[model samples]
Target: MLKRFVVLLLCLLLLAGCDQPIKSGELEKVGLLVPETINDQVWGTKGYKGMLKIQSHFNVDVYYKEDMNSEMIVERAVEEFAQKGVNLIFGHGNEYAVYFNHLSEKYPDIHFVSFNGDAQNENTTSLNFEGYAMGFFGGMVASHMSKTKRVGIIAAYEWQPEVEGFYEGALFEDNEVKVEIEYVGHWDDDQGAILYLDKMIDEGADVIYPAGDGYNVPIIEKVKEHGLYAIGYISDQADLGETTVLTSTVQHVDKLYEVVAEEFDNGKLKAGNLYYDFSDDVITLGEFSSDVDKEFENEIHKHIEVYRETGKLPNE
Candidate 1:
């Protein structure tokens, strides 16, 4: 295992330079930044809810700035928070990671928290969800629920863990299943997403997973028009259509905010990057649709329980 040891040593050396120490400060005031409005029923909404939880839990004043995708806009919002002496700031998405990294040195007293991206500053932390586990479960549901023995997935980027998890999970459930995955290349490209949807439909895909944040709602609505099955991503989308949505892979962003606030309040919050998983109750599957029978649901739960205890999914 000398080769493996050498590789591990190199990786550790690479990380050592950027993994600076963090010190948790008082939970006096907090600020949140979202790229879009909180009414989107997805990522932004979850973050808003999380901020509210932090506000209620800590009894501190919380401020939020929407429409923060542009660097200029984000810098302005952060400057405002800095001026107000906000101690902890949450950037709703990975897009804000760079801006936070660049500003961390300037705002030495403020600690920044964001999701799913590169975070290296001593005052910055990235909260990445272990999404593949939930994706595996969603894939199993889609494969088992699929009638044509063909399934499809639409995602913004191939780098997403859920896409591969769904692919493998489908095949694990049924070796004969055909799985097609399409990338829209951009998160908000609704037209491109729909075109991919049409192509998947034409190819006899009966169960689909739309895994993008900005366009999942419209894609699910279109999936309903075709009377097909879908596995919702990031949030509980059963309200979209109970019959069409088999289940949802959920990320409980609000709970995480509470946890972070609690940690900081208790002087336990750390920096660099923190990962949340099924065991942490952060990444999970939402309630199944009525279409999912009790027997199949129980089987999925059994697998999830085993994973939670043993850290090994069915495929492993």
Candidate 2:
């Protein structure tokens, strides 16, 4: 009778464990907080893609909130996720970094991660990609394709790393090339992009690189109107310009998440800010769709290969 009682209690214990909210021991419930709708395809969408990659590789129960525009909305979303007892939370944008760090402190037991993290917190880990490498590659494309040797860059913001990197890359590739920069102030401002595009075209810029999100539409139209080549970001948007797009700087956030997920699962979550630079292969350049000169391609490939291996480009 005692033996039967022990067996029954053990079975109940197992069942109780199985019924727990987050999987016991190793398995965890993961929550991803995105700044915008998953269709944004610029930043928020990229993070969602990362979340999907993480889910596919690991045994994790994932939850996400989309189209969160305001900080209050983001805070509420994080609180809601906390109430659901998520073990890990991914705040998908740099703007959400401080909020995520704040929430991580509030809920001390949970692990928090921010993409493009700028905050420093004990319980929070931030991941940022090296945009300079991407910019440099883009610069090379612009330098090679520009008939006037004059390139224009329309940025979402001056503070964004990609903007800084773009200039740095362009200068590194060719300081003699005339590069004009125009900040659109916001990611969604099409009017701002149009204003810059008009100015650049009037100034005889044969090539333009649109770094802003939906704001690229006006720039694309301008590129068509002026019959000029343009570089694209986020997506390989060459087709959108009738083959005028030279190349794109692609951020594989999904692949990045896959790396993070595997590391966390293996108990390799490092503390503090984690920066993925050019050497880490975190940022990559898309294929040049233009009829690139064979000699220029070879030269660019050689330089890229050297940079990838040495983590430092020659002369720049």
Per-residue lDDT over 279-300 for candidate 2, one digit per residue giving the tens place of the 0 to 100 score: 6766666666656776776777
For model 1, state the Cα shift of residue 264 in Å. Answer: 1.6
Instruction: Output the worst ten-in-a-row residue range by lDDT, candidate 2.
Output: 21-30
Q: Please give the TM-score that candidate 1 achieves against the real structure.
A: 0.90
Q: Pick the candidate with the highest lDDT.
A: 1
- Write candidate 1's Cα lDDT for 1-316 as tens digits: 9999999999999899568845444787899999887888887889999999998877888999988888888888989998887989999988888888998888888889988888889889989998888888999999999999999999999888988888889889998999999999877788999999999999999998999988899999999999998999889999999889999999999999999988877877898889889999888898799999999999999999999999999988
Q: Please estimate how well model 2 matches the true structure, expressed as its whole-model Cα lDDT.
A: 0.76
What TM-score, computed on C-alpha atoms, does each candidate reach?
A: 0.90, 0.85
> In model 2, where do residues sit more than 4 Å from their true spots?
1-27, 171-175, 239-242
Q: What is the C-alpha lDDT of each candidate?
A: 0.90, 0.76
For model 2 the local lDDT of residue 289 reads 64
